[model samples]
Target chain A: MIQISRLPYYGRQMLNWGVTIASVIVCALILPSRLPGMELLGIGPNWLLIWVVAWSVKRSVLQGAIAGLALGLIQDGMTSLHPSHTLSLMCVGILTASLKKQRYVQEDFISVALIVFGMTVVAETVLALQFSLVGDRSLAEIWTDHQQIALSSAILSSLWAPILYYPLNLWWEKMNWIENNA
Target chain B: MDTLRRWWDRNWLQVALIGLVISTAWVARQTQGGSLFEVYQLLTRPFQSNPSKQELLTNAKVVEMEAKLQQVEKENQKLRELLGYVAKNQQQAIAAPIVGRGADHWWQQITLGRGSNDGIKEDFVVTAPGGLVGRVSSVTAHTSRVMLISDPSSRVGVMINRSRFMGVMRGKSGNKAVMQFFERVPDVRRGDVVTTSSASELFPSGLPVGRVESVNLSQSPAPEAVIALSAPTSVLEWVAVYPVEKNTDSETSQANSK
Candidate 1:
C-alpha cells in the first residue's frame, strides 16, 4: 500500500477520523426519517442499533459498549429522557461483541444480518422490561406493544444491516491491515 | 518494571480513546443531543415537503371562515360573560410542519420543525385541523418533540361535550383511546364529542380531542368509552402549536400561603 503511505501523515489520520464520524452522523440523521421502502408498519429500521452491531462485531467488548452508550444517549436526546435507551443498546453491543463469530460463524453478511436480527429483539425486550418495571405503562399494553415493535424493528434492522456493515467492515479491515504493516 | 511499562504503553491509547467516546456520549445524553437534532434538521431540509397549491387554496378559505367565526364567537362569549359565564382563554396558534416521527416505536412521539426558537415551549398545546393532537414535551432550538395523545403513558381529563360527563382518557397505543368515566350511569353515547375538562391541569379546557365511537356503561370499576380521534395522527403533516396560559390563581394562592 505505497499509495496509503504517500498521503501526508496527519491528512490520512484526519481522513480516517472524518469518515468514521461522518458515518455516525449519517446514521443519526436517518434515525427519524421514514423513507419509502425503509419503513414497515409505521416503524423504520433502527439505524443506530444496526450501526452499533456492525461496529462491535469485529471489536472488543468495551468498544462495543462505548458505541452503544454513545448512540443510546443520542437517541434519548432525540426522543424522551425517561426510560433511557442506554441499557438496551449496551446489551446489544455486549452481546454482538461476545458472539465470537470467528469460532462458530463465518465473517459473512448472512451472519451479520442474523446477529442483528436477534440483537434487535433482545434490545427491544430489555426496553420493554424497563417500561414494565417503571410502571409508566400498564403491563398489558407494554407487552402487546412490545411484540409489534420488536418484530417489525428486528426485520427492518436485519434487512438493512448488511447495507451498513459491508462497507464499514471493508474500511476497518483495511485500517487494521495498514496498522499492522506500519 | 520493564514488562509493566510495555503493557502501559501498549494499551494507554486504546483506553484513552474508549474513555473519550463514552464520556462524550454521556455528555450528549445530558444535553439531550441538541447538536444531533440541529444536524438532522440541516440534512433533512431538502427532503421536507413544501406547502402545496391545494394547501394554499384551502388555507385562504379557512382563514376567511375563521375570521367570521371568531367575530361571532367573540360576541357570543361577551354575551355569556355578561350572564356570568366563565370563559376559557383562547390559545395563540403557531402553525408548524411535522418533520419526523418517533425515533423508536417504544415511544409515540413526533418531531416538529418549529421549536423554542419559534416560541414553542414544553406543555404548549398541539392540535391539528380535526382535533387535539398532543402537547409539546421537549424542545431543541429548531425542533421540538411532541408526545401524542395516543401514547399509553399519557393521561388526560376529558368530558363528553354533549352530556357533560367527566372522564379520564388513556392512550391505547394507536389512533383510538379509551376514556373511563367517573360516574356509573354517565350520560355518554356514540358520536359524542370529547373535550378536555376545566379540571385538567395538563391541558386547557374545551379543546376538542376526539369523538366517542362506542360506550360500555357496565364495565367493572367504571364505565368506558372508546374514542376514534378525528385527527389522522398516523399520517400527520402539519399541526398548530398553542401557548398555554399559566394558572395565575394557583400562583397567587401559593404566594399567599408562603
Candidate 2:
C-alpha cells in the first residue's frame, strides 16, 4: 500500500520479489492446518494450488511453469514421492497462464473462482492418472476415490480462492502500475 | 561473439536468481521442508497449551474403559510370563503437538511439532487416546511429518480382535479404512474391533486401530469391511510418537510377510 513508485528502481524490484516470496511462504505454512471453517469433511483447501493459479493467471507460460515446478516440489516434500504433484501443478500453471485472463474474464472474483474450481478437478485427474499408471491400486478403486476427492476439493478450493486471489491480485496490480508510471 | 556477450551481461543476474530460487526449492523438497516446519513450530508455539490440564475432560466412560483395559493387559502379561514368552521392551513416547495437516489432499498426513532435536525419528508409530494414528515418515530438526493410516497408499496388517481373522487394512481418505480378510468367508461381523497384527512392519503388534462399521462379504477376490478409525484422524490435535527399536531382521521379515 505504501508508495512503491517513490522508491528507487532497484529497491522497488527487491520489494516486489520479497512480497512474492512471502506470499509463497504464507501458502506453505497454512497447508497443514484445519482451522475452523477452512476445512470440508477431512480436507483443507489446496493452498499451494490456489497460489499457483493466482500467480499464473496474468503471467507468461514460462513463468507459470517455473512457479508450478517450485511449488510442486515443495508440496512433494510435504506429501509422498510417487504420483508426484509436479505434473498436476505444472499443468494447472500452464493452463491458467495460457488463458490470459485480462481479455476474457469480466467479473474478477467469480471468474477466478470458476477457474479454480475447474483447475482443481483437472489437477485431481492428473493425480489419478499418475496413480493408475503406477499400477498400485485397482482402477475401479482409484476412480471412485477420484470422484469424491475431486468434487470436494473443487468446491472447497473455489469457495476459498477469493481469500487468496484478491489480496495477491491487488498487490501484483499495484506493483505493475508502479513499474509503468515510475 | 559480441552479441552473445551482451545478452549474457543483460540476463546473467536473472538466470542466476531463478537458478537460486529453484535449487533452494529442490533442497527444501529433499529435506522434507525442514525449514518451513521449523518456522511453523516457532509461529505456533504460543498457541499450544498444556496437555495435562485436560484430565477434567476425561469422561467416566473413558475412565472405566481404561480400567478394564489395564486389567486385561495385566492378565495377558502374567500369562506371557508363565508361557516363557520374551516380551519386548516398552519404549517411551514423545508427545508432540499437531501443527499442520497434509500439504495436499491426495495423501493423508500431519505435521508434528517434535522432531530430531527431541529424539523423534522416521517410522516412529504415533497414537492418540483412542488408538493408533499413523507413523512418522520424515523428520526435520524441530518437526516431523506423519503419513496417516487413513491414506490410500497405507496398508497395515490387521486382525479382527474377536475372531483373530487376519487381513490387510487399507486407508481411505477421511477416517474410514477398508480391511480385506485373508479367508474367503472370514468370521467378521459389524462392530468388530480391529487391531494391528504382529506382521505390520511400520507399527507395533496389537495396537488398537478402529472398529468395523460395515461388512461386505460378497466383494470379488476377498471380503472387505469398513472401519471407523477411533483416533479421530479428522480432528487430531496431539499425538504420541514412539521410537522403534527392533532392528533390520524384524523389520525386513514383517515387510516381506505382507
Candidate 3:
C-alpha cells in the first residue's frame, strides 16, 4: 500500500515476502482461538486449509505442495504428531493447483469457495485415513468423526474463504502488475 | 553449465526461501510449537475473559466445592474403616486463565496462560469448578497445553464412587467419555459419580471426573458406561492446576492387584 511500485526491485521483493509470511503467521495464530462468530460446534474455520487453497489456486503445483508441507508441519506442531498433517495438506495443495490447471473453475469468490469446500473435505478425509491406518482407534469412530469434522470445516472454511482470498489475491495482483511494468 | 548457472541465478532466492521455511517449520514441530504458543500467549494477553465472567466462575466454583466436599466425606468414612487410610495435605492450586482451545478440531485440548514459570509441570492435574478437566501435557515458560479428557486418545482409570467399581475411561469427543468396567456385571447405574482411581499413574486418585449418563452392560466382553463430564470443557474460562502427588506405593500395589 505504501507505493510499492516506487521501491527498488529488491525492496519490493522483500515487502512481498514479508506480507506473505505475516499472513501465514496470522493464520497460524488464529488456528487455536474460537472467536464469537467464527465458531461452530466448538470448531473454528480451518484457516490454514483456506490459506492453502488460496495459495494453490494461482500457483504451480510444486509451489503449492511446498506451502502445504510447511504449513502442515507447523500445524502438526500445534496439534499432535502420530497422524501427521503434512500428507493431507500436501494432497490439498496438489489437488487445488491441478484443479486450477485443468480449467475446471474460473477465478471468482464462489469458485474459490467451492474449491475450498471440496478441498477441506479432501484434507479431513486424508487425516481420517491416517488415523485408521495408525490402528490406535476404531475404524468406525474415525469415520464418524471425519463426517462431522469435514462437514463443519468445509462449511466454515468455504464461507470465510473470501475474507482471506480477496485481500491476498489483491496484493498478489498488485505485486504482479508492478513487477511486469518494471 | 552456462544454462545451469543462468537458471541458478534466476531462482536461487526462491529456493533459499523455500529451504528456510521448511527448516523453520521442522524446528517448530520438533519443539512441539513451544515458541509459537509463547507468542500466542503474549498477543492474546489483552483479550482475556472479563471480570463479569470471572465472577460467575467464582460462584460456580463455590457450589462445586461444596458438592465435592460431600462426596469426599462419604468416601473417606468408607475408606478409613476398610484400609485404615490417612488423608495427606493438599498442595496449593495454581489458577490460570484459559488462553485457547485445540488448534485442530480433532484434538480436544486447551492452552493455559500459566506455565512452568508458575510451577505447572507436565502431568499436573487440571480441574475446573465442576470437576476434572485434564492434565498438563506440555509446558513452555509462560504457557502450558492441557489435553482435555474428551480427546479420543486420552485414557483414564476411573471408578464409580458409590460401588467402588473400577473401569478404564476413554474420551468419546465433546464433553462425554466411555468407561469400560473390569467386571462384566459391575454395579453401575445412571447418575452414578465417576472419579479417578488409584490405578491411574498420570493423575492423582479421587479427582471427580464425570457422572454416568447411561450404562451398556450387554454390548460387549466388558460392560461400558457413557459418562457426561461434569467440567464444562467447551466453555471453561479458568482452571486450577495441582501437582500430582507421587503415590508410588499405591501405584505398585494397584499394579500388583491387576
Candidate 4:
C-alpha cells in the first residue's frame, strides 16, 4: 500500500479507474438504503443519477451515454423493469455532456445542484411517460403520481449532489492534471 | 491501411471497455442485482435489529393482542374444519427486519433482511402490526424485496367485510388506496373493514387490509371507495412473511398453521 503511489503511470491510471468503479459500487449498494439524513418522505437521493451526472459533466458524449446506460441498468436491477430507467438516464447523460459544450452552466456547486434538479425531473417524467404508455394504469393516476415523484426526487437529488460531486470532481481533476503533466 | 491501423490503436481499448460495461449492466438488469443485494445484506447485518430480540421487547398490550389473535385464528380454523374444508399451506411465518426501502419514489418497495435462507419465496405475503403490508417481489439468498400495496402499479382484489361487496383495489401513494367496486353502487360505509377477496390469485383470502375511509359514487367507470390501510406502510420496522404455495386441492384456507 505504501508503494502504490510510486508505481508506474499505467498502474496509477488503473488505480484511478478502480476507485471510480468502487464509487459506483458504493452508490449502488446505498440506493436501497434510507439512512438518516439521506431520506425524504421515504425517498432517498437518486444516487445512480448523481453518479451519472458527476461522470457526464466532464466526459465526452459517448462516455456520458455509456455511464448512463450502465448505471440505469443497475438501477433497474434494484427496482422494477417496466419503463426502464435506461432511456431516462441515457438522455440525462447525453444532455448533461452537451450542456457542458455550450458553457452556459458554470462548474460551481450551485449550478451542479441546479443541473441535478432539472435532470431528475426529466428522468422521472420519462419514467411516467413509459408507465402511461404501458396502459396498465390510468393516465390521471400516472400523472398525479409523477408530480409527487418528480418533486421529491428533484428536491432530494439536488440537495445531495454536492456530497458526491466534490470528491469525484477532485479525483478526476487530479487525474487529468497528472495525465497532462506527464 | 495506415489510417485504419492508427484509428484501431487510438480507439480499440475504449470500445472494448464500453462493450464490457454494457454487457455487465445488461446482466445486472436481468438478474435484479442479486450480487448487490447480497453485499448489502452482508453490510447491513451488523446494523439490522434482530427480529427475535424485537419480539421479546414487545409490550404487554401487543402480547395481549397476539393472544386474542391466536384465539380467533383457532376458532376460524375449527369452523373451517367443521365445514369440511382443507387448509392449503403449513408454512411458518418468517420474521424479518426491513433493511431498506424502494430505490426511488416511483416504486414502492422495501428490502427485507430474510430471504430463501429463511424460507421466504416470491409471492409470499408480508404483514405488519395492523394487517397486510405487501407481497415479496424478488429474493436473493439472504434478502427479499417486497412490492408494497401503496405503489400505484399494485392492484389487489378486496371486499367490504360488512356487505361482502367486491372490488379491485389499486394503490395510491401514502397509506391510501382506491377500491373500484364491481357494482355500480357498493354498500360501503366510512368505517367498513376491508379484506382480501377469494378471487385474488396472488394473496390468500380473508387477510385484513384496511378500513374504508370514504365512499365515492358517481365516478367515471365505477364507484370507488377510499381505504386507509391498517398496516403502517411508511414506518415499517419489522414484518412477518408468510410462505404461500399454489393450492392444488379445493382447500379454502391458505395458512395451514398447525
Choose the strongest candidate by lDDT: 3
Off by over 4 Å in 3: B50-53, B56-87, B248-258
Over A25-57, each residue of candidate 4 has an lDDT whose tens digit, in order, gives 999998998888977666778989988999998
Q: How accurate locally is residue B176 in candidate 4, as Cα lDDT from 0 to 100?
A: 90
**TM-score of each predicted structure versus truth:** 0.90, 0.92, 0.93, 0.93
lDDT of 3 by residue, B1-258 (tens): 999999999989888889999999999888888998999999999998754768764676687888998999878877875886655666999989999999998889999999888999999989987789998999999999999998899999998999999999999888999999999799998999999987778878888999999999996878999999999988778899999986655856878999
lDDT against the true structure, each candidate: 0.85, 0.87, 0.90, 0.87
- lDDT string for model 3 (A1-182, tens) is 56888999889988998999999999999988998889888888999999999999889899889999999999999999879999999999999888854376565899999999999999999999899888877788888889999998899999999999999989998899999999
* Per-residue lDDT of model 2, residues A1-182, tens digit only: 76778888778877887898899999998887777888776677888999999999989988888988998888887787777888999999999999978798789999999999999999999999999999877788789888988898899999999999999999999999887877
What are the root-mean-square deviations of the candidates from the true structure over C-alphas? 3.1, 3.1, 2.9, 3.3
TM-scores, chain A, per candidate: 0.94, 0.96, 0.96, 0.93
Q: Write the per-residue lDDT of candidate 1 for residues A14-52, one digit (tens) a residue.
A: 566667767887887888888889988889899999999
- Candidate 1 lDDT over B1-258, as tens digits, reads 999899988877656766776677777677767777777777777867765732864667788998998999889999989998677666668888888888888878888888899999999989998788998988899988899998887899899999899999998877889999998899988899999886777887778899999988888899999999888887768889999865544445768999
TM-score of 2: 0.92
What residue pairs clash in candidate 4, if any at all? none
lDDT of 4: 0.87
Error of 3 at B119 (Å): 1.3
